[model samples]
Structures are given as C-alpha cells and as structure tokens.
Target: MDTVADRVKHLRKQLKLTQTTLGQCAGGISKQAVSQWERGITEPQWEALNALQRACGVNPYWLLHGTAPMLESEHTPSADATPVGPSPPGHPGTCPLAELLDDLSRRLAAADPAVRDEVTRLVLRYLENPPAGARIAKAIELLLGEDENLPPA
Candidate 1:
C-alpha cells in the first residue's frame, strides 16, 4: 500500500467494487489489468485514468500527483447551508437549462458506470459549443428513443 496501486485499490474498495467490477467501471479494462495495477506490476493507461475520473468522480490530479482530495468537490451546498446573497440569474434550480443538465447528471449517475462514462464524454463534447435549445431537445429525443423501438415522433 505504498504507491498508486494502493490508491487504486483503496478507491475501488471505497466504491465497494471487486477487481472485475472495477475494471468494468474503468472503461472496460480487463480484470488482469486491474490485478496488475493492484500488484504494482503495471500502471494504468491514460484512458483508464480518465475512465476512473468519470466513473468514480475521482480527482485526476489526486490520482496522478496525490496532491488533493481523491474526489473532486463541486462545492455542492450542504443541506444545512443557508443562502446569503441573491442567487445567480442562471443558477441550477432557477434556469431551465441548468435544471436539465442537473437532471441529466443525476440520471446518468445511476447508469452502468461504463455507460455513464461514455455519456459524460458525450455531454462534455456537447457543452463545448452548445446548440440551440430546440437542437438539444431533438438530440435528447434521438438519444432516448422509445423502449418499444418506435421511431422518433
């Protein structure tokens, strides 16, 4: 428990995942790959690191350099915190778009970790230059086609 292997093992346990499950969560890495990492026999590739970040909300800086908290803090207000100043014009819960993004994040968080990771990447790409609201609605409709395999309306 002296190197990155230790940290990886620690995080995996924190998430209550077995080696095989951790591998699956980390971008479909092989179980052998996770074993090797835990044994310090080999290091994780960049993709694995990125996958870990998305799947576990790990702080990449901490994962790589061990400089900060393991999980990235979004400064989410705690239940006991009281508001001081006026809320921002487009703060989450106020703006429809922010609410949509928040809902998407919450829903994705409940998905299979590998799928969540993939969707996170897609959402980040969409955020780079977001389209018109109608375009986003269409995109989401296409993404969430009917379970009955019905075509988009």
Candidate 2:
C-alpha cells in the first residue's frame, strides 16, 4: 500500500491536476508546500485535511492512511446551493413563494456570480438582524405588487 504522501500525490496526478491546482482547492496551500507534504517531509494540519477532503471529495481517513476506499458515500453540499443558519418555515413543497425565491436566486446566480455573491452576502447580513419594519415593508410591497429590488415574493 502507498503511504499517505504517495496516495495524495498520485491522486492529484491521476486527475491531471497540477500541485498548484490541488493547493488552490486546499484553500491556502502552495505548490512547494504540497511537494513537501507529498514527499513525506510533513503531515497536513487537521484543518488542511478537512479542506482536502471537502475539495477533492475523498475520504479524510483514506487520504491519511490509505486503509479505506477513496470514495465517501456522504459528501458535503455545495456552498452556493445550501442554506445557512436555519431552515425556512413550513414544508418545502408546500410554499410556492419560498420555492420561487429559491428559483430566482438560482437564476440570478447563473446570470452573474459576482453580483449574486454580493447580493447573497447582503441578504445574509440583512437576515441576521432584520430591521424592525423590514418584514412589514416587504409584505406591503408584495401586497401592492411592486417588483422593486426584491426577489419573487
């Protein structure tokens, strides 16, 4: 069996990905750092191990010990597609308005990643500590059928 070093190195190579590319996916690694890790000069930090598993869809245990299969049945959901903080109210399929909002967000994201990212950040911030009258104001706007800057209802 290959050592952890060789396994990681081989996996990166088998995907035809440069060390630099793997490093980028690992969040804050550099090619030289990856080279050192692959040569068994050092081991990755716990955080780095998590990042690698997340980025490459490999099992962390396999990456470290090669004792298990590389593929993991469970995977983390994509950042953009997953919700944050808490789940929205009511059953998912029952709310047409919520479904529309999700679909709109997806469409806006497809149109522009940068704008959508900024908008998402803004929305998350606004949601974190919603102003006193924000919900009422939104409700009034919706009742009045004003499109404005809001997503679909």
- On TM-score, the candidate that comes out on top is 1
Deviation of model 1 at 70, angstroms: 0.7
lDDT of 2 by residue, 1-153 (tens): 478789878778866789899887776899998898889897665446556666676555567667446755454435453232222233342222234345344445444566555545444443334342245324433333433444442
Candidate 1, residues 23-50, lDDT tens digits: the string is 9877899999999988889867545666
Q: Candidate 1 clash total?
A: 0
TM-score attained by model 1: 0.47
TM-scores for all candidates?
A: 0.47, 0.46
lDDT of 1: 0.59
Which ten-residue region of model 1 has the weakest summed lDDT? 81-90
Instruction: Tell me the whole-model lDDT of each prediction, alpha carbons only.
Output: 0.59, 0.56
lDDT of 1 at 126: 43
Model 1 clash pairs are: none
Tell me the deviation in Å of residue 125 in model 1. 24
